[model samples]
Target: MENNTQTTIFGLRAIIEAIESGSTINKVYLQKGLRGDIFYQLDKLIKINKITTSMVPVEKLDRLSKNKNHQGAVAQISPIEFHDLEKLIEETTNQNTIPLFLLLDQISDVRNFGAIIRTAECTGVHGIIIQQNGSAPVNAETIKTSAGAAFKVPICKVNHIKDALFLLQAEGIKTVAATEKTEDSVYDIDLNQPLAIIMGSEHRGINPSVLKMVDYKAKLPLLGAIESLNVSVACGVLLYESVRQRL
Candidate 1:
């Protein structure tokens, strides 16, 4: 599997230039204990822009940069541009159709994220909101897994999941979380209305704090021994329920 398809730019100055040029960076890999004037400048720029960074050994930097002179830092450029959550919400609300959105909390697997995006597109999801840090990067594998649906869907990256929830709630969109903690079945929820469905990470279900903020907590009826479904599969079920209700 192609793990990463993002273009890599090495050197601190080059990364700084890319940031200044408004390039969308997936993440930056920096060498451990690298202290220099240029590195400090790049670090400041990364923080100011709230770009994600990882401190790795020099070996990783070399591999990421194809054994080139990475200058103790390497940055990966995102393939697709991200959308603004507030602006996307406004646009969706202006349209004649009811707005349907998806919020993913810390979905770190690229393939799962890709599958969810494809399903979201099919279900007429207006947009997808994910946190900046724990979410999977949109790489070649993800796009391929999405069958090119990645380009069709508008995705937004926020500082925190709660930030997106607050904006959606303020706009009168009800938030629903998929979890086993609630007794309500997904079918019972009113999905025809403008709504945003939240799916938690693979291992851990929706964050407890996030569950408290949602307008509704629902779960799929599990008849078998398995207590939970895959995050992507559960998302499809919820989105299609919304589609069914609207029909």
Candidate 2:
């Protein structure tokens, strides 16, 4: 059944079918102590796909499934299809314009993620890449908060953000991470080249490992006493700077 921003399917068999059919599942809520041949099959599929799962009370599943017999499992399907990173890079590179992409390192808040998508669309970003596990799901709230820009932007889920960095670098795209750790300002960076800008999560800035891999580290100038900007706002400043440089 379709809910606000996600389509949910109950029953172990139904969820297994959904997985086999290539549905992008955001998460699966499993009732504790679920064990059966069908449940095992579903568990294996979820492991192979690395789909997030949560152990929830039966009452929660009851609520999610609207009191239907969920067979101890409920899957929330992603509202938007995800793109393949390598294919997207190849396609973007083939175009005449210089490729511009966004890599989000575990931005977990759905509203913040949606706002970033909205800004990315407005800034002409070719695609957005995020880690599969730690990032926010593109759910109903995200779509609504994005003002429908979630449907327009091509988003790719990677196993690890570093894997994406390697693939993008291999494709001749330079990466720039937005962080307060950098001495360089975003305005000083040359963003007209094929590039991907990395924005870290809200609490912790960019991961140190990711920082080591980036071609450049830059920060938005802070005139106030505040040490950092909100992830979405910082992201907007960085993206618009890229746009201004390219123009």
Candidate 3:
């Protein structure tokens, strides 16, 4: 994610054009003390559309844009539309089949997210939930890693992971946190029920605050000298078990 060239749209007019083109602007960076009619319009548009924006010094913008004629703006352009979590749940539940979802807490690795999305699509998960910030940026690398699954899978970006879990729980879906803190193996869970699987970040497992709210904490058994599995593999394992059970 260092050189986010693929995801960035620079230049003030170009950024504004992106917004007008219905591009999902993840976040916008504006030069501090920047002033102009165009700038004002962009500000007004950002406020009207509720797009995320931050004021940064020109030096920072320059660094991010790699000395391009950015005209004091940089935006992260999203390639796909984010599904509404509530709406997704409603639609999935209305189908009368067991709803399976994947909730990612700080899953910052783009390739890993893509890989999980691929597996989720194969296992027929209803949707994937992630925090609006701190989640991996969907880019070419992610799409490549996913083998194009990123485009097919329903992705829901929420403000807070904990809040998403609460909503899921209230909707009669069991929140399962995959972490080693619990002795309950993934096999112990009844995946046939409405369920949401919580996968954590690469470096850290699920957030402690989120883990407390989860309905069940499940772990995949590790028998080898290694005690940990790649988050993507762990996700696939958790998902396939659900598939295995429902069959």
lDDT, candidates in the order shown: 0.92, 0.92, 0.88
What stretches of model 2 exceed 4 Å from their correct place? 1-5
Task: Tell me the tens digit of each residue's lDDT in model 1 across 61-178.
Answer: 9998899999999998888889999999999999999999999999999999999999999999999999999889987778888888888899999999999999999999999999
Error of 2 at 10 (Å): 1.0
Steric overlap count per candidate = 0, 1, 0
lDDT of 3 by residue, 33-130 (tens): 99999999899989887776789999989998999999999998877777889999999999979999999998988889889999999999999998
CA lDDT, candidate 2, residue 83: 92
Off by over 4 Å in 1: 1-5
Q: Clash number for model 2?
A: 1
Looking at model 3, residue 92 earns an lDDT score of 92
Question: For model 2, how does the per-residue alpha-carbon lDDT over 4-91 read when each residue is reduced to its tens digit?
Answer: 4678899999999999999999999999988989899999999999999999999999999999999899999998889999999999
For candidate 3, what's the RMSD? Answer: 4.1
Name the candidate, 1 or 3, with the larger lDDT value: 1
For model 1 the local lDDT of residue 229 reads 90
